[model samples]
Target: MSAEHTASAPAGPLWRLALGRSLGRSRKFLWFLLINILPLYVASDLLVTSGALAKISGFLEPVMSLWGLPPEAAAVLLAGMLVNLYAATAVAAPLALSWQQVSVLGLILGIAHSLIMEAVVVRQLTRRYHALTLLRIVLGLGAGWLLALVLC
Candidate 1:
């Protein structure tokens, strides 16, 4: 093709278009991550500093024992479900957990985290948010339980 024809081509290189679109998407994703995660981190820090986390952890001790995790692990799981993995990590970072416990928690949260935000997205796309949300929670719990049984 002549230089003029190529320069004015109706369809440019496919990869270039794709890369541009992906870069745009990544920028939006970074913004979304910052907006969602910053508040969670601050809240987690406040909860920890105020001793409220310890009280909540104590209350959740029995329930956490069922999963072979420490009471404080409940805060991590809650943060993951309610906010995101960053929030969960904030909660987990201060705790002392074995590799096995962290692994099990990872498996569980991988299956189910950011429920409210994700459910809204799912609802917009699939119109079955309730069912999907329930399924994710069940799967996460089941996986965690199974992992605990094997690892603990």
Candidate 2:
């Protein structure tokens, strides 16, 4: 283990190595982003505006309310446009959110959403992982809701 650690550890920043590797595969990443991410953003925006999200939100409201999240969160829940879990935070932030609600949104989204293509990218990066994705969603839900209860 120590040998493995020594082999992987470098004298410089990890980001430099990661950036080098990513830049080496920049074309692949760019194409991946183009084919996957752009389409998802468009679709998510359309679906939410087209009333699909409203229907879904209506269904989720009762359950989500338990975590102090309002139904509107469902819109952002489907989209991963936020880097810092921005979508959910944007919705919840304007509201009279308690720390619990904020934490719940933070935790839940910190784990779930953008499942369609991001999960594919994650799977590709981690070698065909479906279970981790599911686990993340479950953990996000549980952890967020739990945080809400505790904090709020």
Top-TM-score structure, candidate number: 1
**Which stretches in model 2 have alpha-carbon errors above 4 Å?**
1-59, 81-96
Tens-place lDDT per residue, model 2, 66-87, is 7777675655555432333434
lDDT (Cα atoms) of all candidates against the true structure: 0.84, 0.65
Q: Against the true structure, what is every candidate's RMSD?
A: 6.1, 7.2
Candidate 2 colliding pairs: none
Tell me each candidate's TM-score: 0.69, 0.51
After superposing all C-alphas onto the true structure, candidate 1 shows an RMSD in angstroms of: 6.1
Tens digit of per-residue lDDT, candidate 1, span 1-152? 56763334447786786677789999997887688666666776777678777787787878898789978788899889998887787678656679989999999999999999999889888978899999999999999999999999
